[model samples]
Target: MKDRKSARTKETIVRAARKIFSEHAYHTASIRMIGKEAGIEHPLINYYFPSKAELFDAIIREICEEFAASAGEWFDAIREREITEGFTEFIELLMEFNRHNPEPLRILALNLTQTKDFSLIPGYHRFPDLISRLHTLYVEKIKPMGPDQEIRMFLHSFYFLIISFLGAGPCIAQVQGMDPDGEPYREWMKATLLFIFLPRLKDINLPRAAAREDG
Candidate 1:
């Protein structure tokens, strides 16, 4: 009973921290604000977390767990369907999650920019292995003519695609002439993914002009 109670308290603190951090960004969010939001005294957060940085790490870990759960669900869905469709479904699921969970996504982006202290986050450690697994999955699905080279290039291209979308939010808004905080932002993200991945561009044979024009 004690352990369960502690677990619940920790969860409440983490959730409150997430909300505060998401709204204010990591640099601006204060432990006092998180405590107030959680309905706990500020000192209690120190008792539970020991330090503000530790609390931030805990919240990031929770976010990572959410990400892992979403990825597992996508993989489970893929296992039940054709393997070729897995990539499309996975991308769509991610876009949908980002569209809905903009807060967490915003927090993650801020953390990436401002912090190097992600040791407590589970998925942070497994990043390399995760990338390898994703690469293998793509290679297995696409089976491009030059399978090995194509997989490498595809991974690189996809990396750039994701980085551009998430990291260049302001630039993306400028290009589309839409407010970064508006609904069009999400639509642009979805359309960008579809434009890059859905057509199986690897299989298409066309001159640079035609490819560029169509793309």
Candidate 2:
């Protein structure tokens, strides 16, 4: 009973911390605010987490673990065939997750822009291995005529573009002269993704004249 109670308390604290950190970011969010949100005393946060950095690391680790577990299940289901479709489904899942939990996405953006200190997070260490495994899965699925590097670059660029588009929603809207409000924005985004992935999309011919001159 005592261990169960402790687990509940820890979960409550972590949930509260995630909410607060998502809004105020890692450096700006105080333990007092987190404890208040968690409905516990301020010092209780210290009792549970030794320091602010430790708490932040714990939150990131939890998120990464959850993502890994969820991805593993999805990957297992689609391991046999049609790898491109599986990859597309995975991207859609990530997009839906970001749309639902915009706060965590915001927190991630802040962390990337402000902090270079990813060494404290265990997830950072495992991320490369995870990427490599995912790439191998893709290679097995799509027996492309191009080199492995070419295929990897194509897939990586596609997902990276998706992430950047979602992550910089405000800036993209501003640059594109579109309103960042309501159903129209969502529709526009859906259309944009469709256009990018359409089989009939045309390629732009770069100025080979310049390359020839340089050569």
Query: TM-score of predicted model 2?
Result: 0.67
> Mind giving the per-residue lDDT tens digits that candidate 1 earns over 1-215?
99999889988998888778867756678889999999999998888999887887667666656765676666666543433355567666776776677555666555555556655432344444545665565445433344466556666577546645754566678787987657788677767776776555433212322544576
lDDT of 2 by residue, 1-215 (tens): 99999899989999998888767756678999999999999798788888887888788766656655555665565544343454456556666766776655455545555566766442355445545655665545433444567556665565456545665566676677776444566567766665665332111111222333466
Q: Count the backbone clashes (under 3 Å) in each candidate.
A: 0, 0
lDDT, model 1, position 198: 51
TM-score of each: 0.65, 0.67
Judge candidate 2 at residue 171 and give its lDDT. Answer: 65
RMSD of each: 6.5, 8.2
Score candidate 1 by TM-score against the native. 0.65
Best by TM-score: 2
